[model samples]
Target: MYDVSPVQLLIIAAAGLITSVIGGVAGYGTGALMPLVLVPIVGAEPVVPIIALSAIFNNVSRATLFRDLVDWRRVRLVILPALPTCALGAWGYTLLDGRGALVVIGSMLVLSVPLRRTLKGRGVTLGNGALATSAAGWGVLVGGTSGAGIILISLLMAAGLEGAAVIATDAAVSTVMGVLKFGVFGVSGVITAQVVAVGLLMGVIAVPGAWLAKRLTERLPLRVHTAILDAVVITGGAAMLFRAATF
Candidate 1:
């Protein structure tokens, strides 16, 4: 169905599987990593749409698997304000050209590393009002980019969620937001047959990742995992920036 060679298809599947596992363990991975693989093959324009559709699959799996742990109140807080902003961001994304798309994606990925660290280190607590306001801003950021899930996860953590609750809540909120973003993309005329084909393929491959991540989360410390992931994200982001400059 794809013009991509079998090897590239295999690479996509492998990246999905690996990132799914990472996302499962860390509360975010597929968004950050998938863009690295997808941009090279599909170009930057389709990368977010591809991941946006696939995320409905990834987030739903986590939400379902961690259903009991979800804090629906937090989900509601994030969702209400994020919806409109998210739609706006997706529409803005549709306005970008290939190089602009690469720059946007790469800059977000790069900025996420330090932003995550700063948020975690401060361990800042957001009151409900602040949380809602923050979610409003976050909607615009995540709606347009692939790697900004870390912002949502950290936002949940600051609002008094930890461990499985954070993952579950993030997943639940993400699923809803994903649907909204997908609708925006569909109506904007960016949702192509290949986007559907690749998204579905990645989604199915990523579904089992949550269960596996559950097993690993209980046993692993995640410091190493986080460190390695940070390196990869930075490397990938830098590479994308380089390509953007050269392009």
Candidate 2:
């Protein structure tokens, strides 16, 4: 377990609080942003599990706040394939070195931006089968990495969801994925006492952030939300890559 000073603890909690607000709006910024703060403090080895554990609280808050808006059909579509595939990804995560996992996580975030813009411009749409296949791929990445939520947001947007529905549905799916990751990491001995403690603290502190985001979402324009999301993804991904390279 890595020892954290009170100041570092404050930083981590603050990160959760801040990112959860963005996540509440975008359905993704927490995972994309939190690691940029965490990996350096705790090192890469425990960051994924820590974030996964913390995400349970963050997602639950969003899912609950936006319960009425959740697209259950889309939730089922993503979760069905993600269930088995995410387990496989978690298993795979156990085999990767810290640098490899960080690189993968970083690369996924960076690449997803261009991919999202391209797909948006092309106006590509996925049918059920294709959507399921894409969910499976996301399952693997999300199970193993820190920033795969952006990809899910893109997929949901492409599937015709907008505004609250996108955030709500993504939260529902992500909540389940977080539970799955927690179990896998727990059983695999990846979740240590320090991880649990930090995760719980961060999660609790983020609750208000989620509430705040819900309020903001009602007023925020979709175009503004999209722009902020892209900026965060790019910056977070670049930071992770820089850390991995230096490591």
Candidate 3:
């Protein structure tokens, strides 16, 4: 059911190990990094499903690792709006061509960095209603694309969730999103045996990476963490945009 060569599988395993660690620390990396590897192997059509499937394990690990810090209130706020919109977004994703979705994902990623910084500098924040409204919009984007977790990270940061709180809350919300996306994909016949098998394999291999990140999160300075997250988001976003443009 899967087309990946043994060599490609090896490469994916390595990427999975690395990106999971990054996800553990930054609250979002697996989705951003996996597509860079998966798109060429699985093609664009399956990349989102694959990411969504694997993400169930990835976020589960992170949420568990950071369970002590997760803000259940924020999780509730984000999930309430994100759930219904995500279903719509998944349906909408079936309508978009590969390049169209890539363009949307890339644009959102690139724009999010500056948007976040500007908001922080001015002390701007969203009330619950505004947050729910924004979550509705993000639900659509995330449902359709890989690497869209940065959107949630940005939203959480804007809402005054700093450092560990941001990662923990993002993880909780992403866990639910992962489950929702999986259901949508499964019902749509997008989740094949190969996808599930590969996703689970990568997920198990990624556990150590999350463990390492969990240890580091406590030691890393807040500004350093923020900078790393921003840099990764921008670089990943730029890569997506470049790929989309070339495609």
Candidate 4:
């Protein structure tokens, strides 16, 4: 039971499925949205580790579905340079107390709105050297955070990937980083039987989400959905910061 009430477990499962569908349509959701539920139910420290494990399922599915579109060259460019700092960042996350964890996750969630917009609109292209260097910085941020995958998607696009290529590349990159995060948390002794159980349940429920999202993508005006989601994220993030300050 992972020490959770059945309702809490249900909430986690619902979050996984809802966020998965949101992610399938939007290219980023689980990382941004999952923390809103997980933080309250499990406390702040476990949020990143739980999401790190659950995300492996989400990203790996996207990678497989879009495997043909993945740019191996860009994957290589981003992954290698990112590994070291990713580890450093993951390790740093382990050191945060509950309040610190809440602030970090909340602040990132709040800023992700403008940061994602700015990166998406960033018309400047990157050369290989610059892309790799930028990825190193991305590694640090992503390693420690849940919602930073949007940054990776933007990076891929700015590096000349378009359409399916960007999604495919981001999924592949995130799969690897997700594994790296799990390993770092595992080594740091954050992994537990409860973590594995909850993460698996969430993943299994989410596995079919992309297919469901395909049906909704056409009817759902992405602009409207995105705007609404942005509002929710900002509100949820600010709430977390408030909780952190008062806790």
The per-prediction CA RMSD against the true structure, in angstroms, equals 1.3, 1.6, 2.5, 1.7
Q: After superposition, which runs of candidate 4 have C-alpha atoms over 4 Å from their true positions?
A: 215-219
lDDT of 3 at 198: 75
Best-matching candidate per TM-score: 1
TM-score, structure 3 vs. true = 0.87
| Model 2 lDDT tens row, 65-176 | 9999998988999999998889888878877788887887788779878887887788878777877899999999888887788889888888888878988999999999
* lDDT per residue (tens digit) for residues 10-126 in model 1: 899989988999999899989999999998788899999999989999999989999999999888889999999999999999999999999999999999999989998988889
Residue 152 accuracy (lDDT) in model 1: 89
* Ranking of predictions according to TM-score: 1, 4, 2, 3
Error of model 3, residue 85, in angstroms: 0.6
Per-prediction TM-score to the true structure, in the order listed: 0.98, 0.94, 0.87, 0.94
Where in model 1 is the C-alpha error above 4 Å?
none
Output the worst ten-in-a-row residue range by lDDT, candidate 1.
1-10
- Give the CA lDDT, 0 to 100, for residue 27 in model 2: 75
What's model 1's lDDT at 85? 97
Q: Give lDDT: candidate 3, residue 187.
A: 90
For candidate 3, the 10 contiguous residues with the lowest summed lDDT are 100-109
